[model samples]
Target: MPLRLPPLPALRFFEAAGRHQSFKLAAAELNVTPSAISHGIVGLEQALGVELFAREPRGISLTASGADYLSYVSEAFSLIAIGTQRLPNHRADRPIALSCAPTFASRWLLPRLAGFRARWPNVNVSVDTSHRQVGFPVDGFDFAVRMSRAPVAGTAWTRLFGERFVPVCSPAYLANLRDEQGNADLRRATLIHVNAASEDWQAWFDATGTEGIDTAAGLRVDTIQLAFEAAAMGLGVALGRRPLVDRDIDNGTLVQACAATIASTTAYWLVSAENADRRPELFDFKRWLVSEAEHFDTHANPADQALQSTAN
Candidate 1:
């Protein structure tokens, strides 16, 4: 008996399109036209007797079954890649490829990476800050740091730490918001909002029972880093995520706007490949990352906790 398989070219197109979720993007990556991708996908689906993608006005999305199939396909491809790299002629160097959100990389990871480099001088590491959702080994990343409320399936997830959202502003700006009672009042303050966490303001208001402020009206920015920068610039009171703001508050760049903190529902997590036990570098990095997180939690600013309450 022979092993049954679909056309290799058809599977290639499905893999690329599945990874990107866009025929146009997949076509560009493969140096072909969108129509070619579409045709290839159609043929593959017909042969399998199942629709792999849901075509819509905005873009395409993988069907539930298709998504499940993709994981297996991607794993197979990754095995081939890994085997090829192990060939005698292949380069001896294999860097630990890491994928993480931009803000996380800048504010938290970058500051501590020097220590990792110092410890493992011989091990090379590469960081990618793309905002795209990675497809595991298909994306060539050994590990990823993502923020999520619940662990997503199909990958190994390691819980990091949760962030508390608190309103922070320049000391000068905070002084202006002080009421006659000398307590900071947000009733008349300009709220700075990070679009990624647009609901932070509402959630903060709800959780803390803070009244009389409009959560919708504010200076809008795309990223948490930008929102923090705006708050530091005295533009307005922006909700700041912990650890990210710890340095700013310590340096007097920003201060607590009010004493009512709300914990974010999402926690930072490290996702890794299922077969990561084979990679010693990944294990070493994971251990170091977890240790740093624990140390951070143990030594969280006790003084600031009392002063920093309330959020975006």
Candidate 2:
């Protein structure tokens, strides 16, 4: 009825030491000082009422009792990792849970989701829009679509798409820029930025080779949709993704300020842990997802920037 478990710090210390066979090595792995690891192991040994290791001149070695205990500890940890990874997809029989950025969800995935439902009629789906970097086994999500220049550590990464962003604004904002120079106009206008990627403005500047741009002069939001909405409402100009704002550009809701476009270092990444991918349901969900991604790509051109003159 009661959960009887050793203190987490002690167990963690023991697990690290056992795996590495050295307090020093474990300490390095865990980002703690060697003295801290030694102290933690000492505490763990007292709690367990047994000697876990033999200190040698060269390094540490596990005692017989320690070796036996380690096997159980290792297995327990493996199971814990498995359980944690499964939690997000725990409702596998129900809705397939997917985590993504709010703007990416709203502008891209949300509109395209109906096709997934229609195709995979038996498989239910749920979407969570968040910018937090959630650990695979800890967050209880089946898979996540993250915006990153490269693969995130400790996860399998699938490249979804490379986004090309161009400066977009409401017609009213462009009217203000009517008299300003090409590069100077953008600098004069209120610039809208997404906070999630700090290098976004810099990368755009580098790609466009547009010098003398000040990134500090504008409003920053975490989600791209918010930035787009702000730009659409005549709040400011935003670097807008072509795929996400295709409909808006078509309908003349947003206008491109310059003919120049830059490729974003941030890309849509489909990610899941190795253990999580082992589940059959996860494979099923992934297969369906790949299909949906292909479908969206078919209609959306990766290249093709329509100017305001043509859009209107």
Best by TM-score: 1
> Please, what is the TM-score per model?
0.82, 0.68
For 50-121, candidate 2 gives per-residue lDDT tens digits of 999999898899999999988777667766867755577554475667888776788778777687677667
What is the per-residue lDDT of model 1 for residues 123-142, given as tens digits with 9 covering 90 to 100?
A: 88899886566766666777
Q: Itemize residue pairs with steric clashes in candidate 1.
A: 259-309, 260-309, 260-310, 261-309, 261-310
Candidate 1 global Cα RMSD: 3.7
Clash totals, every prediction: 5, 2
Best-fitting candidate, measured by lDDT? 1
Q: How high is the CA lDDT of each candidate model?
A: 0.83, 0.75
Error (Å) of candidate 2 at residue 174 is: 0.6
Give the true-structure RMSD of model 2: 9.2
Looking at model 1, residue 214 earns an lDDT score of 83
